[model samples]
Target: MSDNPKPTVEGGSDLPGWEWDRTVEDSEAVAVGDSVTFSKDITDDDVVRFAEASGDTNPLHLEDDYAAETRFGGRIAHGMLVGGLISAALARFPGTVVYLSQDFEFKGPVRIGDRATAEVEVADTLDGGRYQLSTQVLVDDEVVIDGEAIVLIDEAP
Candidate 1:
């Protein structure tokens, strides 16, 4: 992680539909040692829609009986579905963001009606203009999944 603290906007970067500018000079700041958390409740409809849209019809996420037989003992949401929300947050933040890679570790099952929170912390900065962010998804204060994401932001134009 590079220790340089200056924020600049790249013109004509690789990210599509994004114009990087220093509109929010502190947008990228991680407050030295603070973490940023974004949370939302998971509804049954959310799970069903995600399953339908992603074409992942795993019975464990839809069939209660089948899910009950599993270790979770109930239906759970698709891991990527919860992950997608984190991606959405990163994209909406004030910057030209590009997801480079992600490493996810599912800690527990995420059931419908559980309020999940996604937290991100600026972990490191690479020399190649990439940001390594520490991310996690939690339910009822229990971390359901955690991972690290690599994002690239270049000058727009």
Candidate 2:
């Protein structure tokens, strides 16, 4: 949302190889057009761990042979797993970001080992410290998921 982007925070994650950047310096200044980006690479361990945690052990995401036969041509990451990146982006916001609702359209497949970047932009200011954000996840500079989310940003207590 910011044309002149400034790095409010960089390499904010404690996890290895994870990174984030916030366009606005003040996280408490939740306004229309504020944006944040979070990036990480999807790895084999991530997929297996996500499957074990979420119970979404679909063969297309886990079985290379099965996935190769499908239209995707190879194993692909879970859609929701990639969508979760949007939440990762929101967490970089200046306050406690609570999600009320989110809706997503999976436009394309995200292969394992791809670097996924989630971008969240505050599209509109809502009543009661809430905001509507446009959320997107991209792999290789191609949008793989697009969505909208409503979140309540509460002051850090």
lDDT of 2 by residue, 94-119 (tens): 76789999999999999999999999
Model 1 lDDT vs. the true structure? 0.69
> TM-scores across all candidates?
0.74, 0.90
Index of the highest-TM-score prediction: 2
Candidate 1 vs. true structure, TM-score: 0.74
**lDDT of each candidate versus the true structure:** 0.69, 0.87
- Candidate 2, TM-score vs. the true structure? 0.90
Candidate 2 segments whose C-alpha is farther than 4 A from its true place: 1-13
